[model samples]
Target: MKLQSVAIFVLFLSLFVSVFSDTARTGDWTPIKNLNDPFVQEIAQILLKEHEKQSDEKLSLVAVVRGESQDGAGTNYRLVLEAKDESAATNIYEAIFWDKSFTHFKNLVSFKKTYLILLFYNII
Candidate 1:
């Protein structure tokens, strides 16, 4: 009986440590390695749709430029996307989405236009 109690206690302690370690490393944004990942592209599409609902502008996702993810209560994805509006003029945007995978809940945290700086060279 005493041995069983000790085994249970050890199990609980190990579980606690595992959960704590996972929670401790969350909340820091990490760079996404695969820009061409289908899942990343899907997230970009989701962002465009959500943003359109709020802004009433029909935007289409052209590509997922880059992104980062931060884990916490949910995972927050920050992405730079290349997109075009109804008129088809391409533009860049920085969009953030918070998604809770377990519950399948997601929200568009923010979206705004971003600009790309272009440099030109001249040879004389």
Candidate 2:
């Protein structure tokens, strides 16, 4: 009877550990369900403004194509955006932004013209 109890306890402990580990893991990016959510649009706008400031390009955000976000010290957004300047055709860009709203801190991590844009240009 004692041996059976020990085995049962061990099984419960292992189960608990597996569940805890899954919950504790971080940095897994998950797709935003509502692409049209105002908050997601706001994040995309922020990325465009930051990119414009850094590059001195006057690009207006046409739309957010898609995005995923990861939770960490701040929320990290990976977005595919369509934007265009005054004289240029709409182009797709991929950008990453990290935001900590509680602290009012935000950073533009990276931005680059995506292959889709390059392929579009080549075909035209």
In terms of TM-score, which candidate is strongest? 2
Instruction: Please provide, for model 1 over 21-111, each residue's C-alpha lDDT reduced to its tens digit, 9 standing for 90 to 100.
Output: 6443667788898988989989999999999999999999887777889989989999988799999998888899999999999999999
Per residue, candidate 2 scores C-alpha lDDT tens digits across 1-124 of 9999999999999989987774534688887778799999998888988998999987888878778899989899998888898797888888999999999999999999887654643433
Which ten residues in a row are the worst by lDDT in model 2?
115-124
lDDT of each: 0.85, 0.85
Worst 10 residues of 1 by lDDT: 115-124
For model 2, state the Cα shift of residue 19 in Å. Answer: 7.3
Q: Give the Cα error of residue 84 in candidate 2, in Å.
A: 1.4
Each candidate structure's TM-score, on Cα atoms with residue i matched to residue i, is 0.72, 0.76
Cα RMSDs, all models: 7.8, 4.8
